[model samples]
Target: MIREIQSQHILQALELGEIESGQGLNQEHGLGRPGDTRWGSHYKTVSNVTALYATIVKVLEKIGSNKIYKDDRVKAITVMSTFESFEFVFMIHLMSEIFGITDKLCQALQKGDQDIVNAMTYVKLTKEGLQQMRDHGWEDFLHLVVCFCVKHDVEVPTMDDMYVPRGRSRRFFAKVSNLHRFRVEMFISVIDLQLQELNSRFDEENTELLICVSCLNPINSFAAFDMQKLLRLAELYPKEFPTNDMTMTALRHELQFYINDVRQDARFGDLKGIHELSMMLVETNKHTTYNLVYLLIRLALILPVATASVERVFSSMTYVKNKLRNSMGDQLLNDNLVTFLERDLFSRVSDDDVLERFQSMKTRRMLL
Candidate 1:
């Protein structure tokens, strides 16, 4: 119904010269459903709702008045009432802004060739953006919400007026103004919570590990290589580098020679990431010469990609084990999951090859 209303509205606007021919809507412009794994979807959902607010309201009104089912009418009326409120409008706008800040980081993390360095950079930018919003964005954001309410015919409560709880008596509860509730409790508090969550998730240890790992990035002719951070990264892995002063000194010396040789070699100049660097090191037979540095690079590549692969495996389980295969045994389920998850590799195997393998698994009754 929302899509139908949006289509009609767009067509009417185009016909009346209010919009251009090139301004037609696409799938992305329509309302989006939020997904658990995709943070960008949440941003799109809130943005589309705000953009099509009037159209959504119209749809709800039609359902409430003309629907034959009592439950449908009740649901539509309830949703319409909630949508036509100043509080809801404020929240939608607030979330839209917050999600917009983190959308880039979300996308960076989701990419197949994930760049930990760039991802960490984006995380920093997101935190900074949220902090700036919390500190200086209140007055402007509130004004925007107020203008939206006034334009939509929703009642805009006076900020200085005393806020009264819907079901509580003023005598029993503490008195607070609308400004305190919305600005302090809602806006500032929400941004603070988001910042806190980011800090907690990407704490000092994790951030330092990623930053040190990024020192191995081969982009820009090894511009990100920092001897101290790379040494610190090696120190984090005590078993690999050992606890003695001699091992640390040897690693530092190897790092110096490794960076020099790679920076001067033209073959390593165009490498994009640490993975490619690892491959190139082996190809050039340099891994044996600087085995310690190679070991460090291997360690750096393990965590992020391995973690993403594990997550992908878990996510694939849902598709591989559906209701029809609910009673599948452990071994059968594991085999099926392997076949499904590694379908790209399996795609190269011919049907004849699979048949031959299956035939070879056990003796058949007739071999004619």
Candidate 2:
């Protein structure tokens, strides 16, 4: 039985059926169901093809000299990606229940509904999103570093000349062809490029991560940046900020730039936290200079920098080994180790209780 669909119903159904596919409409209504009604395949006619070509050309032409997008690539992505960002947004803006009908969308969007306009908001990438973008954006940087190391031009680590273990270190990383690559600093180059392209978005959190990554490079890199992220932050968000915000921004600027640049730019002065903490390193401390400083900086950026804190958490190796090494079989030793390591379980017991258990073991046999 042929069920008749009203002209309005067919328009609405077809409109709802329009699919983006980054292609033209009427190509086929593949996205949504069209209620099994067959129409004269007007969607496939020569006229539809010509209309699509015309529609695309018109949009491309209309892109420039427009206020909303500003015809900028980033802005274009921001605007289109915002609209392309969601279906409800597109449907509300277009008002015709259409999917990929560009003319209808443009027309509906021109007379955009107040409620739809109220709901449709711009979407900027969050800090996490920006970091994910950087992880992807800097693949070229890793390739460049790989190339530089390949040519035996890895950046010098120390001020005084010291021979690099060429066999061990050079073989570890890749190489580059150009002698100019000798001057190239991998970490700073990536940082500078990121600052140049997207400096406007650098919040203190992002800048702090930048500082931590800069420290990871073996090279002694002090960047000559045209734009300090701190300066950008000061420009965008002036006046008082929380303690972490100021500290993070200062850390990045100091780490990235040369001594002169840092001294000149650090209006608040060198981060005294590092200096103050170093004073606590007494002669009795077993950790080396490198080890001590590593602990301090790692502690500062614990949340953003890494999972290094979780690594230092073995509380049971000494207790388990001493308690069970002689008396227990290997399987029992494993069980004892796990029990000792579960600090929360041990925590529930008193210190006196542990001493009593050890004393009983001592009475039975020599303590393991």
Candidate 3:
């Protein structure tokens, strides 16, 4: 059914543009293909399935009842048995709600301009929201599941009724109420595990590090720069910034003076990142004045940028050097990769400027 819907949508899109094909509706909002590295894609697939549940159910019913195709009828019956139940619907909604919170965090972190401080905040908020859902959203979610089951003509199990074990070796298993089995054990436990994983990964140390690193941002007239946070950032590296009382006190004073001097200068006012700040300081020959502070800033800047840029380079390489270009020479490949990676910077260069630089690279026989 999903394949049919997607194929029909694609054909319509090819015949008419997406908007016109769906009569101004979301024509391209068909099924999604989820992959291992893409949590957002999985979430989108689940959401689209939920959105098209009625159509899916109708298709499944038609296939299950069709005596003409025995294989299809059997497969459709199995699918209906699995997906057309209250438990499945409940799980679908539950997972969608949970993934919705995480989806935002996933997107925010992927952005190049993403702020560490904001990302930490998002993590905190997601954890809190998951906790709230576990505590307060139980009854409401159950009510929603019940309503959906009623609408679809599926049996809504009595919450207070005893649930029996469905196995061959049912040797007098202890009884559990449906309410406790589904609501407490399944629902609450699932949410608790997710919350635990998030909390463990995004602990206090990580949060503090993000907040400290964010202090170096020089945007809006260096508004994010905090002397205390900068000191904390320095403290994170004891080998670089000594923890001895005398050395720490003098380092604090140096940091204060450095920030004050930079804030007063008009040239530093427009700087956006640690990279730009470092470059400007080098241009003015002031890196030696605040050597320790400069070293810290350089470390903070390079690690994150280098890691992200390297990943991007490798990702783009697959597209740039496919199987067809397997025999591409290393030097030419390197040059092309550099140009592609630095396209933003290259875009600002004029054709004449590029020609001049290329001509100046060597004593060419003739100039263009």
Candidate 4:
């Protein structure tokens, strides 16, 4: 009987395989524990499986050979049967490739320094990547899968063969070859669906409004700024400006004043982001001077930043308020979330500052 401690032998095999595979300094890269909260983690999991395929198979084969541990043997056999298949290999590679595109967009969107222009660019690039994959990716992908199977001594099924649907009890099975089904139904159809969904979700829904707001962005020396767009942005806030010919004329002149003043202003010259631009306006006491334009930039900046912030809050909430702590009170949970979510901000805060705030919260029985 293989001792429980002998599982280290399997881990050793994985380590050797990682070195052999030239995984660089990350030779310690083991099976990835994909996260439920992080959607991009699925790509990492699939990639790790692909990289450690041979090692995993070797470990599973050894475990399956163990007679005394029947449960371990059965599990090994089940895993081997499931994993060592043409469809499994194909799906792994396919999903990994597709996820590579999505993972980039996901990371970019989650960044604290994310720019709307940059995010929009990423969205466009992701769509194009999916489209390119749909059009020309099948041949290269098939070659990769075939090569992996050959290297691992896994049986490569004949693509042209008639694909018999498993289980005789099934009714109305579609007549299709493995090649056609894999290429058309699985690959092309899935990519098409992804592309369609991306377009629907990130399409030109608020593109015009976004473009108008982007003019106020302090990025790249405000290269994309358009006076026309800025005027359009001001026209958007009807509540701030009355809808009369006299008010409209005055508003246009005020916008012209803002553009000229900001362009020549040294304080505005060094601004980096929307947040900085908003804060600088207040620091230099210019917010009230151009109250309507300030309001516009504030609105534009808040929507995207706030959306990203809320998403981060929810992501943290998943970890802070999981099923184990399901009975936690709302106020307690909120306080915990605030600290956890704002840890980056808190890290820069001095210990003395924290102690002072703690002392101010309430007079303690003893010194805090």
lDDT of each: 0.87, 0.36, 0.80, 0.79
TM per candidate: 0.88, 0.17, 0.78, 0.83
Clashing pairs in 2: 147-175, 147-176, 149-174, 149-175, 150-174, 150-175, 151-175, 151-176
Q: Which candidate tops lDDT? A: 1
**Local accuracy of candidate 3 as per-residue lDDT tens digits, 86-202:** 678878988898899788888776667787778888998899889999989998888888887787777888889987543335467556888887888789999999998988977
RMSD of each: 2.9, 29.3, 5.8, 4.4
Window of ten residues with lowest summed lDDT in model 4: 1-10
| Residue pairs clashing, model 4 | none
Among these predicted structures, which one has the highest TM-score?
Answer: 1
Better of 3 and 4 by TM-score: 4
What are the per-residue Cα lDDT tens digits for candidate 4 across 1-368? 12232355456766788433333643434565887757678888898788777768877888899787677998998899978988888889899999998888888877877766777778889999999999988899899989998988877878999776533432565878889978998999989999998888776855566667777887666666777777777677778756778877776777788878888888788788878989988998999998877877777875674556777778888899999999999999999998898898888999999899999998789877
Better of 2 and 3 by lDDT: 3
* Backbone atom clashes (below 3 Å) for every candidate: 0, 8, 0, 0
**Candidate 1: Cα lDDT at 46:** 93
Clashes of 3: 0
Instruction: Kindly report which residue stretches of model 4 are placed more than 4 angstroms away from their true locations once superposed.
Output: 1-26, 166-172, 232-252, 318-332, 348-368
Give lDDT tens digits, candidate 2, residues 49-106.
2223223223433453366647464554444433322221212322221122222322
Worst 10 residues of 2 by lDDT: 114-123
Better of 1 and 3 by TM-score: 1
On a 0 to 1 TM-score scale, where does candidate 1 land against the true structure?
0.88
